[model samples]
Target: MVTVQEQGDTVVFTVEGWHKLWAMRSELRIPRTHILGARRDPEASKAWGIRAPGTHIPGLLKAGTFYFDNTGDNKPTFLDVQHRENTVVIDLADEEYNRLIIEVADPDEVVALFGPAAAT
Candidate 1:
């Protein structure tokens, strides 16, 4: 699981508990402009693949920075996620990560953090 925070003009997502030990990364931070959209989607996990540089145990766990592919001259994108269900799928742009998929106790509130202007 991860914790999301709005620090003034930026957004920060922090890894917690055992997930920190698995991912080896503590947090992801980016400016609000880098966020394209956010939503709750359990299907996001279906995209996980073995080629990605990360840890996984089938339907049980996922925690790491994963590389799916690249686009244009933009930095190669990444996917940082812990769990699939009850997830907050955040679409990113102009950053090293193309998308962020993380599971939290409350998916609805997490999605609401982006407000109505945010896309699903």
Candidate 2:
């Protein structure tokens, strides 16, 4: 699992426990302005992007960095996901990454931080 925290103009994602070992990533920070939006879909499936410089186990886990180009949101994406349900999907601007697929404890609270207008 990961914890989401806001520090000044940046939002930080810190992976915890063994997940860190699996993801090969411990922390990530992005500016709030680069956030496209945040959403929680309990029915959301696994990461649908190409696994590049990352880890995956079909329907099990998708941990590491990925890339998506065909969908237009093409960029280096970071994912540290364990569960398929109630996943927090944070869409990012064209900065370092285009998307973040991760699992958090509270999806609703995390999405709220992005606000409604963040998507547009």
Q: Report the lDDT of model 2 for residue 44.
A: 40
When summed lDDT is taken over every stretch of 10 residues in candidate 2, the lowest stretch is 41-50
lDDT tens digits by residue: candidate 1, 1-120: 888888989998888887886766788898988787778878766564443456676678776766543333433333445556677778877777667778877888877877432543
**TM-score of model number 1:** 0.80
Q: Which candidate is the best by TM-score?
A: 2
Predicted candidate 2 versus true structure: per-residue lDDT over 1-120, tens digit per residue: 889998999888899898888778889888888888888754443536777777788878878888765446557778877776758778787577777778888888888988543331
Backbone clash count for every predicted candidate, in the order shown: 0, 1
Instruction: Supply candidate 1's per-residue lDDT for 31.
Output: 95
Error of 2 at 79 (Å): 1.3
Where in model 1 is the C-alpha error above 4 Å?
50-52, 69-83, 115-120
